[model samples]
Target: MYNKGTIIPGLVIFIVFVTFPLWYNGLNAGTVPKPDLPIGQKECVAPAAEMRDNHMKLLNEWRDAVLREDDRVMVKVGGKEYRKGLQMACMQCHNDKEKFCDSCHTYAAVQPTCWDCHLTPKEAASKKETH
Candidate 1:
């Protein structure tokens, strides 16, 4: 049997180690959204154009890195590299994909097909551990 004093320490540990992450993730989950370009910019014009260009550049770099099969760039867990496909999820870099991916997609009138095919990092990590 545990002492009453020990129970308080154990509860503190649980709150710090377990409940904190749950609360943190819950708060962050809603914070990710896509980029929002200026309104009425058909060709990604003006200041918004620069943002679009930068975004495309980043995406292209990511694509190129993946095509080169650069395992070194892959996401690491316990110092192990995950495969490219498994690592390509939006949250890998853009932790706020709801804010980053969705916001830009809405502005561009383009529906990202990511949700149609890909699982989120949280989901993927969970599945990975079970397997």
Candidate 2:
């Protein structure tokens, strides 16, 4: 290893660059976001843990079912029928999107596409009121 003087330092620099993020973040997964729960509503379409992990997947399935199969698709949970949609079903209870949705999503560093098509309940109401 005739080039050990330059090669060893180069290898060290490369390793540090590769592992910098892991060290900077202390291998610490960020704190779990504490989203505000819906008031006067004790249950969601799915259980809390399932929803936390797979809400996007569930929403995508709901979107497919509603758009491809039927617009009036209803989901029955805990003896209640909900018209499958972000606005119609989910937002009925989780009206404050900033508090309920944004908190968790921001922590997870995701930008959901749902808002591209639908307004938050508060926004919809404000627009309706102005009109």
Q: Best by TM-score, which number?
A: 2
Q: Candidate 1 on 1-131: residue-level lDDT in tens?
A: 56979998888998888778676777565543445432332332124457456755654565667767564355443344444442453344444455556675765577755566567656667899999
CA lDDT of every candidate: 0.55, 0.87
Global lDDT of model 2 = 0.87
lDDT of 2 at 3: 93
Give the distance in Å from residue 53's predicted Cα in candidate 1 to where it truly belongs. Answer: 3.0
Q: Mind giving the per-residue lDDT tens digits that candidate 2 earns over 1-131?
A: 79999999999999999999988999898778888888878888878999988999999988888889887677775567888888988988888999999997898789999989999888899999999
Per-candidate TM-score against the hidden true structure: 0.35, 0.79
